[model samples]
Target: MEFLDEIKAKFPNVLESVDGSNENESVLLLKDKTKIKRVCKEVKNHFDILFMLMAVDKPPKIFELNYVFSSYKTQNILTIRVNIERDKAVIDSISSLFESADWEERETYDLFGVEFIGHKNLKRILLPEDWPGRPLRKDFEVTDEVRNWTGLDLKF
Candidate 1:
């Protein structure tokens, strides 16, 4: 279940390889958006199961996408992460690699407003179509929230 070399050979420098935990663990941090699809494919080939997918919208300039995969053979946990830009926030869907990523990618897209370019069910999973902004992003703000909350400090 050692695919680190495979990853290295296929896509050099795409992964800033994370050292495994003292226990049987594998983790890799991704640095480029374009390389995520290849990494996802490698992970699925090696692991067979994608345990989870999540995204975090860090402020100002970047977002982080995280994936947790489990190898059915070796029973190891592997983490993959990629940092993306705020404006050009798009990545390939992992549905081609792992079928389980369908719902997870939808959830991440709905919540974080990231575009999974090839997802079949890329639609709102948690929010309605009318939802104003990507709530999880640190810069997201409701336009009238302060007025709605404090009611203009009426003196009546």
Candidate 2:
């Protein structure tokens, strides 16, 4: 299934995206967050299903957001992605447009700590409310319970 042609036929400004196949798939890097929602809807409306959502932690600065969509109509799978900055880690919510995106967005926020600006139920999906730093972050530290493990600290 020529996924790019199908996408262009459905969404005019979705940007030029490449198709990946075989036993593996590469992320379709998007220009920005706005197209993320646009491409997602186009895929669903024209094709008819959602495959999955993924969030990759890009250390020291940002997170990469990915949405995988499949069409029962065309039997093709397409992955769309966007990079969200560390400082402004929020993106417009597609939950308003797609019901399934609700839980996926929450899961991303929960694990990677990226906020969805308009997500009504954007909250920790797999972590407690009071959890300290974002565990998935590359810079996030995993301190030993026994600080004296290295025998360098005398403070109790």
Candidate 3:
């Protein structure tokens, strides 16, 4: 698809680096988390759907967010990854561009403690609002409160 070449030509400032060597999918690393919305808006036409939004807690400093996009017509997958500071794990929400990103973003927020700055309704989806901490984070500690909340405190 020459996707990287097109992106470089059209939106030179959006990507920091790209790995287009894979035939099945292309991976792009954004230079800044704040530019995510801009990039999504530009590429929304090429990718019909935001297939998934996932987060990875890289201990000691970073939280990587992967925004996977798919095109039904072209059967192509493109992933845009952005890394934010672990302590300040916040990023612009792409829900405005893709409907599917709404729930996916909320799920990531619920589990990873990421703040989707412009999400219309950013709230806990899977876990309750009163939940102790973000369970998916690498630094999360399993305390009695958390264990009891999940009924993990029950003895077998």
Choose the strongest candidate by TM-score.
Answer: 3
lDDT of 3 by residue, 6-28 (tens): 76566677685564447558888
**Which structure among the candidates has the greatest lDDT?**
3
Question: In model 2, which residue pairs have backbone atoms overlapping below 3 Å?
Answer: none
TM-scores, one per candidate: 0.81, 0.75, 0.89
lDDT of each model, Cα atoms only? Answer: 0.78, 0.69, 0.85
Q: Which residue pairs show backbone clashes in model 3? A: none
Worst 10 residues of 1 by lDDT: 144-153
TM-score computed on alpha carbons, candidate 1: 0.81
Q: Which tens-of-lDDT digit does each residue in 46-74 have in candidate 1? A: 78788789788777788888898887878
Q: Give candidate 1's root-mean-square deviation (CA, Å).
A: 5.0
| Native-referenced Cα lDDT, model 3 | 0.85
Q: Which ten residues in a row have the lowest lDDT in candidate 2?
A: 144-153
* Alpha carbon lDDT at 46, candidate 1: 76
Better of 1 and 3 by lDDT: 3
Residue 30 Cα positional deviation in candidate 1, in Å, after optimal superposition: 2.0
